[model samples]
Target: MPTSSRPAAFATAALTAGLALWTSGAPSVVYPVYGREWSLPPALTTVVFGTYPVTLLVVLGLFGGISDRIGRRAAIVLGLALMAVGTLAFALAPSIGVLLVGRALTGAGVGFALSPATAALAEYARPGRGHLAGAVATASTAAGLTVALLLGGLFLDLLPDPLHLSYWPLLGAVLVVLVLALRLPSGARSSGSAVRLLRVDPSMRGVVAQGALGVAAAYGTGGVVLALGADVAVGLLGTDSPIVIGLVLALSAVTIGVTALLARRVRAGAAAPAGALVMVAGLAALVTASAAGSLPVFLVSIVLTGVGYSLLFSAGVGIAAELAPAQHRASTVSAVYFAGYAVQAVAAIGLGQLATAHGLLPAIVAGAVVLSVLALVAGAAPFVRARRAVRTATGGNPA
Candidate 1:
């Protein structure tokens, strides 16, 4: 690749990253509409949401390192093509079954594309500034999420074909990104077992665990927000307008992008613990908001969650970048995301069932407890390791 082309490649890669989230979230605002039109239960709606991550988990496990062997450009193009197909499915879907299929295809597409795009960001980063790739990746995904919520809401509120119109634009965006992906440099391919590429070294296992936990905490919170935030907003705001719901929910994504840029200078080790603490606070606020049906508190919770998500996600990416072998970078990043999405799948589906069986408030309280514990554990892991190291150095004596 020419030096001149690197910048374009970087931008294209970022766009691909953005498209992955944009595609995943495109259906979020329409989920409630599906329920109303189809007379579906809350559990069924959440199943549709959870379907994406469930399929993504399978793809990530099997093909997470495919880009390393097939070339980044090839992997990305294939992923985007699948995304376009999935988006089209959503646009034409008239039944819940079709929607599930669409969600699955979109999940598979993201599983294939996101890790590779993230690795490509580092590959194209300027020398000595590789860290910026993680921040840029975070900001780009946040931007995508923001657009999905904001525009999906707008289309749902103002357009005649609320269910289908939002997805047509998303499909077009996927095709456009697919074109840009084709122009990206076809970097050299290597031969390796995908499973072998995903294996973490014994020495790096602890760091990998911490990174994965932090990412899981972020994704878990985000899953709740995406899965149930709209209903929560409607309850609190006393409005059924999709546009208002979207604007209110989009606050989290807006804060995520802004915080990633502002906190780019923060070190991963520091950011991980700090983000965990903030996430705990956010979860508490969320629980309070649900109990009181307070819109202002809900707003605060959304902003806090977004800030926490940015910190944790960027830090996880930073850790993966710093520790990954050049040959297996994509696989390493995928492994981190795999953990995150697994938690997200569980949270979305489980919370939905809880909400359906009990009530939204109880479900929110339960989710907050689980997420808070996860965040606290992620925050404490680094310190625990540091203390262990100190003890070992002192021959098991107290400091």
Candidate 2:
């Protein structure tokens, strides 16, 4: 009803947007929805899941910072429309072609909304509580991923009308969010110098390095495992149940979801190193899983890596926000995201290709190696910066 309540509204919008995008994959929990009903192939399933990131990366890259120039409201409203269209299309799909189209549309919608939604959170932030925006971004994203899979599975197993139940309810919820979206003040207005957005000025090589190393570590480990683990789980381990899918692929991020709950307690510098360590541990577990082809070890690794990915993702947002100038905060975030997605894209393609050749486990080892290097860099960056700062402050060198 009031402008001051916009942040609360945006938080809801972001959460909804996330939920919508995740359904594109979460319905895999209801593999019956597509697998048997449409006779969808395994390759097609990979396409369905992989297509979201492709469209998402492209849309976010081009339009990611449009809100910074055009205003957050328009970007968000457009994104919501896209998300609604895409989700509904998939829900009502008469064929796999339409399903793919729907998935593409979902990606486009979430991509449009993704950046704008974050920007909206910025505008809607509560007084004297700016970090609320970051928390909203991180938590909503994690919420979307977790809730989408869990609820989608529940509806699939328990409801007679799984498709309608899984999607229509979400569509209705987004309708409520659309109504809520109307209340947000246009982000184009000048908020004045008193409240400035501290942005990560990425022209600085240091900021780019910070973003690249930090995000690569998290995404390389978590994104890779999440994206590819399913094939390994199903193709190699020979499983068809939703519960198994959730445990292997989705549950990996569940640990990250748990870590997100601990965001407030973690220190500024600690998240990166901690994330690095946990991810490394996760990758190591993955190594065992890869060698032994043990689903149990693989499942445990997913949980551990997820915790680290969540922490690093959220922490990266904060750090990226800090490195920027006031005018470019959103773009700084965009840059960080671009790099993150870029890393994921490369890792996916490279590993996917390798998986195509050497087999899933070897491909997984490649991803682990990439992330392990990234983790090393992440563990190194803070110390380098700290030492440099100390050297400058001391007017020479360290003892």
What lDDT does each candidate get?
0.85, 0.67
User: TM per model?
Assistant: 0.92, 0.83
For model 1, the superposed segments whose C-alpha errors exceed 4 Å read 1-4, 38-47, 193-198, 384-399
Error of 1 at 199 (Å): 3.3
Clashes of each: 0, 7
Among all windows of ten consecutive residues in candidate 2, which has the lowest summed lDDT?
189-198
List candidate 2 segments past 4 Å from native. 1-7, 13-17, 20-24, 27-36, 40-47, 120-135, 158-165, 189-205, 231-239, 247-250, 293-296, 385-399
Q: Candidate 2, residue 184: CA error in Å?
A: 1.7
Worst ten-residue run, lDDT, model 1? 194-203
Give the CA lDDT, 0 to 100, for residue 262 in model 2.
Answer: 69
